[model samples]
Target: PDCEKNVKTLVDGFAAEGSPIVLVRHDSGDPESPLHPDRAGNAFKPALDGVEPALVVPKHVHSAFHGEVDLHAWLRREEIGEILVCGIQTNRCCETTARLGGDLGYDVGFVIDATHTFDEPAQNGRDALGADLLAQATATNLHGHFANVTTTAEVLGAIPAAG
Candidate 1:
């Protein structure tokens, strides 16, 4: 989908800016689960090739901050006060991290356009909520409370490229 392309573009933009990009992968730890890092399904996408992350965080939980990895400590050690959170499952991991980051006292910039989600059937099973609709709802929940919801273009435009 466009998520792969969009995430690639954003990662490249950050690389151009000399910003350290952190790649977080979910490892369910269940050998039978395809989500395990040992499984091919959990492998990083080709778009992530050549993009070395400052840190590779393997998380089991939806929130990256809540994982065993000491992300908060690392951020504090680096004195990084703000974070641009973007990735798949707009209403899940992405939203969870944004909320937790804000609670951790970091200014969060949520790139709404750069994130994506899957559709879910309505509670009554009448219809499925489209991806776009889910994204909008995530933005609403994060904006002004957890983080500032923006786009990839806006974020790239805001940060100056590395010399």
Candidate 2:
């Protein structure tokens, strides 16, 4: 819910600037998976209730670039040179997509505060990390290399001033 506020703000600003908002959703393609398109978990969260995206892409993979929805092609077709990514599971899909976009020659802006993730258990019996720490780690990895880790306000401020 907290991250949603930032995401909503960013989306609204982009909409005001006539920037296309591409909503990339996960669909595991397995009926048993909660992320299956037919499952309730696949529905857009309440935070996005009134937001209308320019495009809604359903993907079967973590990286939107490798999804069945052909997000890369769409971006190319639309002449999109940059992407602002914010969503659930910050360390997984959001991070992967940002990295892929950068490798593909697109400038990727990863809104750290606008992305969220669940607490992750320690892999080797160490202390588990909280969501906030995970989010920060993701931002640290993405910054300077894959994407420009940014804030919603910074991105909004970069939009050209309305005439």
Candidate 3:
């Protein structure tokens, strides 16, 4: 519920500081998929309606790094050593990006509250895993390992004020 709000807050805060905001959108190949390029569902959230990102990456895979645009190359070209990650499916795309970012030697901050996911049925026929549980697990797995798991407030506080 608060994910969109927090994401918007983070985006606004960073944008105010002239930070490069990279927006990643999943574009599915299947026309029937909601995430297909031609589908309205592929657009960014309403919260980000007026926000303009430095880069808009169209990705078919989970990790934004493997998108049509060379995310790493662009970051390097712009001399961006650190990145803040926040998006849908906290345990999927967000987690994958954080992990890959860490591997690529970038300082990654995973905005915990700015990302969210849904409950999923267990593969072994056990009870469905709750979204809260999945979120917590993602935090635990990334914190101090793949990325610095943090909140929107913390990220906002870290950004330097506009001169």
Question: How displaced is residue 29 in candidate 1, in Å?
Answer: 3.1
Higher-lDDT candidate among 1 and 3?
3
**Could you tell me which 10 consecutive residues in candidate 1 have the lowest summed lDDT?**
154-163
Show where candidate 1 strays beyond 4 Å.
123-127
Model 1, position 42, has a per-residue lDDT of 91
lDDT to native, each model? 0.88, 0.86, 0.93
For model 1, residues 1-163, the per-residue Cα lDDT tens digits are 5777878988998888788899988888899998887799898778899998999888999999977788999999988999998787799999999999999999999998778789989888898998889898999999999899998778878877721
lDDT of 1 at 89: 75
lDDT of 3: 0.93
Per-residue lDDT for 1-163 in model 3, tens only?
Answer: 6999999988888888888889999999999998998999998999898888899999999999999999999999999999999989899999999999999999999999999899999888888999999999999999999899999888887777722
What TM-score would every model get versus the actual structure? 0.91, 0.91, 0.96
- Show the colliding residue pairs in model 1: none
Best by lDDT: 3
Better of 1 and 3 by TM-score: 3
